[model samples]
Target: MSPLIDCLLIGLGATLIMDLWGLVRHPLLGMPLPSYYLVGRWLGHMPKGQFRHQAIAKASPVPGETLIGWLAHYLIGVSFAALLLLITGSKWLTSPSLTPALAVGLVTVLAPFLLMQPGMGAGIAASRLPNPGQARLHSLITHGVFGLGLYLSALGLRLFN
Candidate 1:
């Protein structure tokens, strides 16, 4: 398969795995599922020149915000997969490694820490959160899982060859 196709599949697969982790964590760990709707709401305001929010949930609702959020979530995943491929080269897709995947996964957390969370009014690295350390831990673990997904998805795709 072409590298582009590989990236698309890898990104989607990785994102799905992360979502599954969220599902499992909820019942087992008592963490609530992430609200992508808030992500959408934050993006929805982009056109209006609004990047940061005191509280995204309090922001005016955007039409189809939930759908927008979900799409963005997947697109972001795909983009991150592309980043991994870029860093390791397209050839890496044929023989994935855990170290690179984990590195990329952990690095992806910066987006939420520096951009997404702050845009949604959560502060840098969720410093504004009631329990910032726990939140950071959750984000770290989630991103790590995403990295694993990247490696696993590549391996799975190889099976089709």
Candidate 2:
């Protein structure tokens, strides 16, 4: 298969795993499922020069924000997978290992810590959250799972070849 096709499969597989984790975590732990609609709303406002919000929850809803956010979520997942391939080179995709996948996944947490969280008014690393430590821990774990997803997905793809 072409590298691009491989990457897409790997990315989609990894994102699916992460989403599955969310589904399992929500009902069991009472953790709310991530609202992609809010993400869409946030992105929708970017062209209007509204990047940051005191509280995205209070922000006006945008049309099709749900779809936009979900699309962005998957795209971001794919981009991260591509980043992993870039860092480790295409050779890694053939063999598929754990360390690099986990490293990339853990590293991705910086996006939310610095940009997403702050942009949404949660403060850096979710400092403004009711339970900042817990929230940060959740983010860390979630990203770590994403990393595992990367490895698992790669492994799955390897089986087909």
Candidate 3:
């Protein structure tokens, strides 16, 4: 398969695994998972406001919009994986060290912390949440899972190759 195709599948797969695990472990339904699939819906319906807090709440995407968000989210993941593949090439995907995957995963935080958060009005690192500390911690954990997903997906790809 083409690298892009491979990356797309890998991204979706990783997301599913991590998300399912989250559902089973902590079933907060909307609050925690927020139907990640609706990332685009959330982005699309985002209320226009200068204030970060207001904007995020205004962009409150519903379950109906989740499909778009999920697609967008996975696409981003695939893009991330493809970048890694390009950097290291196929060899890396097949037998990548956790270092690179983990690095990429961890570094991925910038987008949410900076753009997404502020745009959504949650403030950086979720400073706008009811409990900023817990929200930040939760985000950290999820992103950490994403990093692990990268590493595990690489291992799986390696096996296939």
Give me the candidate number with maximum lDDT. Answer: 1
lDDT of 1 by residue, 1-161 (tens): 89999999999999999999999999999999866988999999999999999989899999989999999999999999999999999889778889999899999999999999999999999999999999999999999999999999999999997
TM-score (all chains, Cα) for each model: 0.98, 0.97, 0.78
When summed lDDT is taken over every stretch of 10 residues in candidate 2, the lowest stretch is 29-38
The C-alpha RMSD in Å for every predicted model, in order, reads: 0.6, 0.8, 3.6
lDDT of every predicted structure (CA atoms): 0.95, 0.92, 0.68
Error of 3 at 51 (Å): 11
Order by TM-score, highest first: 1, 2, 3
Candidate 2, 43-117: lDDT as tens digits: 988989999999998999898999999999999999999999999999998889999999999999999999989
lDDT of 2: 0.92
Worst lDDT 10-window in candidate 1? 33-42
Model 2 stretches with alpha carbons more than 4 Å out: none
Top TM-score hit: 1
